[model samples]
Target chain A: MAKKSFFKRITLWRYLFLTLCFIVVIGNPFTNYYWDINFIQGWFQSIGIGNLWVVSPLEGLESILTAKFFYMPSLVGMVIPVTLAFLMGRVFCSWMCPIEFLSLLTDKILGFIPKWGKDLKYRKDLVRFAKYTLWFALVAELMITMIIGYPMFVWWSPPGLVGRETMFYVFYKHITIEAVIVVVVLLMNLITRRMFCRYFCPLGALLALIGKKRQLVIEYNASKCVGCKICDKRCPMGIKPSVGESQTVYCWNCAECVDACPTSALKFVWRDRGFITLPKGTKGESAV
Target chain B: MKRERKTDRREFLKVTLGAFMGGALFSSCSLSDLKNPKTMVKSPIKTNILRPPGAVSEEHFAQKCIRCGRCGEVCPYHCIKYFDVKTGGVFSGTPYIDVMEKPCYLCMKCVYVCPTGSLVPCAKEEVRMGVAVINRQICVSWQQDKTGLMCKTCFNVCPFSGVAIKIDHDFRPYIVEEYCTGCGICAYSCIADTYPENNGKKAIVIQPIKWKKIKEIKLEDIKKS
Candidate 1:
């Protein structure tokens, strides 16, 4: 057995990334309050860097749907995030989302409860069905946003609410009723694992769709795999990296499965392979 | 296995159908009212509540704003505040100025940071956040005969002192509405309202101008300036 170097651990790097993201989103107000430095402004929904902009693709879509016209500035703002998704395959979910950080924390807390923690896990197939159903619900939410003539999710979006409430608390010294939605979502994590990110987040769904053919993906070398299923158990998104299912769009590129692989068989690779490509010697059929 | 697969498929269909039904029912109830231009035409103009400078019409502002809170973040004076669900409905998360609390300083950083152009970039002199109107009944300077105090707090704080607000020979202040950009500094610094007898009423207040009024005024000003 060999000791893994600290830098080799993906989990440490991910936590660091999440922490930096939290500071960027929540610390903007503190900087404004104390030093009056506003080089970077805004929350998860939209961030303005100097004169450039990076807006959430879901919000951009909603704005276009409601306004019924293509706004050039918003279109320009969408380019950065859309390009990131095209290259990284929903890295924002694992790397930058504050809600995902909270979800990971909740999972750790739930792990401490005796007996009930094990029972809370759902069957894999049931979870898959629920994810698909919620993806459809995201579509319905966009339709409602169009019908209502406003971005409906802005009211309850967990990541946006986290930033909004933090700003309110910093500026006005009192958070409003909107912070309650974030609390409710965090509480809902008790019943389901990463419930909002896995099932309900429109931004995640949008990123998933945009990054469906992402260049960065998990590659499985079948010859080296021992089939110990450690990667399966360690996957936060319930993806099977051992079976090459980590190539799916829902894979957050968090590399938990790759980190958990005991045989060092699973690895992240930059390639154009479609979803679920089995190695040449494997008897399992490859699916696109 | 075959029976389980069939049931799963049936359940999926049932859920999808239920979602569509829910969306249809919800939209049917509120779609017409939201679509009506007449309802949207009535701007969200409340006393002393001004939108940040260069804000588009209130109707379009709600639709275009993504609620990024960038405007509030870049505001130098920290005068811009967001409305939560408790404070507003469609306007929730939008940036607004409560003139009585903290007034806009006309730095115009919020306009530049707005991604969707909800707050359009404009010159400081071209701002039309609102118009300042003096309440003669409450103004100490206006009632110089009775009070004889000659308090010039508002006149002293006006950004465009000589152009927007002017004092007469008796040191009584009057608002020149044409030149007033309605940045609200005058109302924020008014001493008349701070007096215990005034019961927190502002002597000089920024009355928010609707988009229709701005369009009429700006069209002529654009021709001149």
Candidate 2:
């Protein structure tokens, strides 16, 4: 058999994504030279701010920390990420999330240690509730902190860990009490893959819900599935599309399922369905 | 398509009202006063090798800052903090350089790092923060030399070197008054602040005291203890 073309075998976007991950997190040492420059730092800051715009839903659920939340210098917080989530379903998590990329690398490393590695499998549906529960507790802590005049979540966030290390120790020669909390969180993460992200990231839960909306999802052609289970087996988040009518809440709209289909049957279709002409034999039974 | 338009005119008005009230309530605090303190004062000019310290009034600082943690991040020294205030209104979630633990050595990291002009840059001779008035009655060196070796802790800690503070031959430390940058290092690192609780051995309140642009204190006020 003739060798498959590289384009037909591996996704170009995945490589770009990996490249972006390396540049943002691992390549920070090089990027740190320009960390203070307006353009470079502002890019990340703007993305963070972009999520703050449609944050009304997240904010309405209030905790103390978020209650004090105000739009910063730019309105980027509320505008960009929300618009993207509405359009492409949490692409930030898949392409740009440092934590997610790190977790994947960690999972690969863990795979070398015999039986201990086998348990480190990704399951989308099983851990979908983790984000929601984490959201609830985060909001509750915000409320409690507000009444008590203390911000409890600051010491437990991933960004907080990195920040405390950079600011308190690196710059000031001071070790914050939050260092202990960061160690404990990291230890827990070592035991469970993406334990903090799956179960405790309020921001992740908010994005996941936005992705879960019916219009903004990956639709599967159940009739064309043919029980190959290739898509299910290849899914990073362990979603089983062969058994379901819809994608899981945590789906990142990565189009992996489309890539995995043996028959050229999978395609992204909008629910609006504006005059898509189908073949005659195929009655108007829309794909899931 | 028109039906999905969830927000209408009335809803827009409500949001506007909420924002206006929130902004108004927030601006009416110390932050606003710091920015536009109903008064402005002139400082005596002096030549110096180091860059002079200048700051935007507190109100202006509070309003302009977005608290994105940029200045704090960019600081080579990381001496700034975003004070989590319950009552300071606009500045409640804002950042301020704590000049006590580490004075702004006039490195200008904070001024440049501040994406917004909350911490604006200044010329060498033009910068003037509030002056430190020595409370003679409460000062250990002045009060019968109670805990004194004629302590000059504040004089030694000032980032401006001997320009902001002076120690006489008798070792009595005095605020130079004119050169005082009001960076608050003396207040923060005051050995007295670290005394009292442990049989007079503790550091107490090192508050980032809010200053008015034209505020003044008489010597009698300092002597009142």
Candidate 3:
């Protein structure tokens, strides 16, 4: 059987997707002319690529909640992201989140960090999945603050803060505290992988809650498996995607582990129709 | 592979319960708490801040605006500037026009471009962004060689000249607040441009304010009369 090259790996594809998203974010400002076109707002808003639209559900929620009056058009803008989550889980985190993009960049620059420390102290655990609780807290906070008639500043959110700063830094030549906070976020990731996306991104938390039950999930075939734990080592988000225990809610489907699996037991199985795996031609040879 | 967390789901659930309990206790506060004129916690909207035309009232506008920077991008005059920390407090990054620098030309593009109704959509004449107040002391017309004969140049510059602004018997420009859409063209076109003696000031200034109801939209004007 022919082996997949390193560049063609799933993680690499995810990185490529991230790169495409990055281009759109910075390139959007230049594209907006008078009224003909607009790029996505930023990390806090949509993720448009080429002519395709990828909306931000969180923006819609914030506008509706904080404004206390719903605008039909803005509410309609949210359908794409919500539908994507319903279908593919929170792939936005793995595929296109700017924070995830920043985390990967910083990880590469500080490449000497001993491969995410395999020690049990650094191993994936229940606490790592505690981001759901953080998500709950933010939504709860939003409700309380809205009830108080002074919605907490959504601009102060990590994505909003960073997105604004990125605009100014790239186009306006000024660095506000928002930009400074983004740098601080990057530095924090040195201590762990994607600390902001894992625990702080309210939007991500919102997506995780919505996309938890997506049928397009990572499934494990334990029968043909060796418990080598290589998947755990390769996971950037620290997700465990084996033994029916994958945190599909948090998995971006970056597919790093699928590439890393020596047994080749790991493959995307479309659960909608009983276990349809990819690379159909290769799957037959690998199974034999 | 590691010892269990010191703070477990039990602690998490306990906090969640506390939040709901606190919420219940607080929601009991009367509706009058919201209506009390003497709001103890000084609201941010008390001051009349000019927002882009089509904006909701200051109170609702502040909460609704997502600070997307879209309206600013669409303005031909580049009048809309996002409020940074220096100018905007909690309202930073929302769109506001600096009339003295560059005023809205009644392009109506910004109102159209607003993704959220942070800037509402309205006809050019219906837009009541703010009112342009002409300062007699600084006005060149009033100061022209100390002659009581005012230049009335402001009337020539006013977009809604005959209606929004007019000259009284004394030839002094008085803004008929009812017609003034506060497009800031008078300030932008002020003959009394900033001179060193004035310490960089114009004869007219657009003060951000919310006042009396704007007359109903003239639908006839919506189409060519």
Instruction: Give the candidate number with the greatest lDDT.
Output: 1
Second chain only: TM-score per model?
A: 0.76, 0.59, 0.70
* lDDT of candidate model 3 versus the reference: 0.64
* Best by the DockQ measure: 1
lDDT of 1: 0.77
User: Who is ahead in TM-score, 2 or 3?
Assistant: 3
Candidate 1 on A45-157: residue-level lDDT in tens? Answer: 89876777888888878877776667788899899889989887789989899988887766666666788764444213233444475578679889878766777776577
Give me the runs in candidate 1 sitting further than 4 Å from their true place: A1-6, A50-52, A68-71, A109-129, A273-288, B1-45, B149-152, B167-172, B194-198, B212-225
Candidate 3: interface RMSD in Å?
3.5
lDDT by candidate, in order shown: 0.77, 0.48, 0.64
- Considering the true interface contacts (CA pairs under 8 Å between chains A and B), give the fraction that model 3 also has: 0.36
TM-score for each candidate, following the candidate numbering: 0.81, 0.56, 0.79
Q: Report the lDDT tens digits of candidate 2 across residue range A1-288.
A: 233356764334654685575454333322333354322232232212211321222322232133343334333344556666665565666655655555556656767767765555433233344335656755665565455332334334443344334444433455545456545655555655456655666655666766555344566766766787767765655456666633566666556666676763454555443334555565344433
DockQ of each: 0.53, 0.07, 0.27
> Looking at candidate 2, what is the lDDT of residue A93?
60
